[model samples]
Target: MSDIFEYAPAPESRDVVDIRPSYGLFVNGEWIDSLGDERHKTLNPATEEALAEFSYATPADVDRAVDAARKAYDSVWGRMPGRERAKYLFRIARIVQERARELAVLESLDNGKPIRESRDVDLPLVAAHFFYYAGWADKLRHAGLGEDPRPLGVAAQIIPWNFPLLMLAWKIAPALACGNTVVLKPAETTPLTALAFAEICRQADLPPGVVNIVTGAGETGQALAGHEGVDKVAFTGSTEVGRLIARSVAGTRKKLTLELGGKAANIVFDDAALDQAVEGIVNGIFFNQGHVCCAGSRLLVQESVEDELLAALKRRLATLRLGDPLDKNTDIGAVNSAAQLDRIRELSDAGEAEGAQRWSPPCALPDKGFWFPPTLFTGVAQSHRIAREEIFGPVLSVLTFRTPAEAVEKANNTPYGLSAGVWTEKGSRILWMADRLRAGVVWANTFNKFDPTSPFGGYKESGYGREGGRHGLEAYLDV
Candidate 1:
């Protein structure tokens, strides 16, 4: 932590926008006070400094947001022509691009990811999502749904902290494409980008109350999830929370889609392209400091390749640079927040206590902020907690497979079925493994590749529905 603050201060930006330190709930197309006076400060996980303060939306505030959404659905959003809705989405996409720098900086500061990723990956994907869905706004009649397909009305959406602005686009773009009003809640740890999205909406001339942002912890999420006025609920978070949402909307008329936690298996066979496999494993498990829900937390290798892979992986992990997220060369950033850091620490400790051979690359972690070295554990069993549970961090648990059949069995052994990766030269094996793997998304010879046209989600306890592509509209469309 001390090391984090000890670094020289970042130079004053030449950019025009001054990042704000406080934000309010955006409801009815306006920034309003929380129904209660309570507030929570969002922090820079890199520096442990408060980057901004955001309203803690209460139950009453949720009611207000939902009512505003309902009003918008009836008076403007629902009645608006799909082409007009398409134009709004286009406008939002343009605004997002025009203000991409501001968003990327704020996202990096609050979420502690590299500025490059926020700009290149998160912001671009966000804008692309709107652009892709925008085209669909007027084409729903041809979208394979019945000719008279209608919007789901008011949608209540909750996004996780990992990819704040982009996830917001994933939820809002499709809902708007289908003509549904939205009440969105950004994760407590990273609310600045969502508030920034509200400002973008303001610039786009999006109708009052079409898109609303409420900031709070899990309780605020519960209010939105269970709100009677909400016609649909979309959530992205932990599997445990997703299950609660599943049960909450069980007997109700409200529709539900949940994108939850994953403990993905990245399998490297003896025949894999070694360099590609090494890079894939690194990116699969270490990107975003390993906070991704679809993070490949478990490393599955053919027994014959285990020793060679570990040697290369250890050498590669050792070379990664870690520190301030804004640094041009920083490959790993701080964990999202204190609580998330604790979770990672506890799991890593469990790895050591449970007798796995723990090894973290030699790197310096700042004392002023949450930081953990890129880690790996060898000699792991499927029954081990390190291998079975979703640590949601940079830690990877290693297990060796003697055969392809055993690999498939071990990969599907977990409660989660979010994603998996297979590295092999055999064409038949790729399709066969893809068939046997019980995951929503499978990467063959690649990992973590995402596109707006490709739907991404999980199976089993990883929750339901899809978040991108033509299939993504299912969550917001009326059957």
Candidate 2:
């Protein structure tokens, strides 16, 4: 809640999306009622308003979707040449670009992320994943995977709610490009954009059953991931759920890839530009309200400049805006849901109980929906729960290190190794730290930077397999 930069309430219009009272499951390329009676309403976490009710997919519904995907794989997608499949992926990407504003607005309303992020970050990245994969569809042979890499029959893809459409594109684009049919399940809280994407699949005249979306909670995802018919399973969410999915697919022919949780360390040395490092620190843990799986939640500053860096970081965080997600001026928005908010609060409170000093800027929060002020914890130790765990919110835990050796040791101490950041002016120092760091992705002067062409995933408990670049095609293809 930063009041340093005050602006008018420039809220983005939500009329771009036509929300239906109820949404049926998207299976076999069409909307259909779920066989089960379970129903849940998707909410606008910013206002706690009901956006729409969505049917939860039963085991039977999962079977129907798996059957459709299998049918499409055998009859259409699998047999089609990569070049022919590329055309469909291209169409989807183009349509997403054309409807970018609508999707951005809908994304903000449903996911409670700032409209600026949904529009500039999420929507563009969503389209980029498709566009990037569309170009790769006809070039898989040159991808160095294999001469004739074949699609892995049916793919069961379950994406997280934080970046719904983007994660959908991350899973679906590469799967389709590699000649596989997919049965996707968007996260329960943010299903509107994925449902809209099902319409986009229709608009592209994609063959029936080629791309299917079944919306529900964990149970529906469980049914789909555990189904016997799917040849590939891809998921992006919590580490605990990733473990369950990994176990479910074990001892089976199903190929699996998981992008799970992280407690990334953003290291800043004394030689780093203080002003630049401050901004990077803010972007590292505060981006997406720190809902990112690979967020740099642990700040490992050089002991020499810890005081200077902390002061600058605190000042920058105080200028960040927090309020209505639809407001074009807002920086931080609502937490995704009450459950996630509770988790953030529980962990943050534990940080205090464990003796870490907590600080927040003076700002009034809206009373309507889920909200947490951007928080900072100093005097943090590696053993502290806040430093060890993934808070997955706008909370930063600061810890200092003495040397390069100590920095690497501290950064790699966590069970998660999704990403890490190094902020030093020396190129040699950056290269030195990057080589020693255990993280899958290492940023030198930046934080939270993503590109469609770069391969990304993590080591150990953070999950396995890459999700972008030529390496991404490997997950959906059989070598």
Best by lDDT: 2
**For model 1, what is the error of residue 252's alpha carbon versus the real structure, in angstroms, after optimal superposition?**
0.5
Compose the digit string of candidate 1's lDDT tens values, residues 1-479: 45443444453242635677678889999989887988988888998987777889999999999999999999999999999999999999999898888788888888988776777788999999999999999998887877778999999999999999888999999999999999999999988888888888898999998998999999999999999999999999998888898899999999999999899999889999988999999999899899898888999999998999999999999888888887756788889988888998998898888899999888888879899889999989888888888888889999999999999999999999999999999989999999999999999999988999999998998988888998898778986
Candidate 2 weakest lDDT stretch, 10 residues: 2-11
C-alpha lDDT score of every prediction, in listed order: 0.90, 0.93
lDDT by residue for model 2 (1-479), tens: 97655587998887888989999988888899999999999999999999999999899999999999989889989999888998999899999999999999999999999999999999889889999999999998899998888888999999999999999999999999999999999999999999999999999999999999898889999999999999999999999999999999999999999999999999999999989988898988888899999898999999999988888887888788999999999999999999999999999999999999999987689999999999999999889999998889999999999999999999999999899999999999999999999999999999988999999999999999999998999999889
lDDT of 2: 0.93
Task: Give the per-residue Cα lDDT of candidate 1 at 7.
Answer: 40
> Largest TM-score belongs to which candidate?
2
Of candidate 1, the 10-residue stretch with the lowest lDDT total is 5-14
Each prediction's total of clashing residue pairs, residues at least 3 apart in sequence or on different chains, is: 7, 0
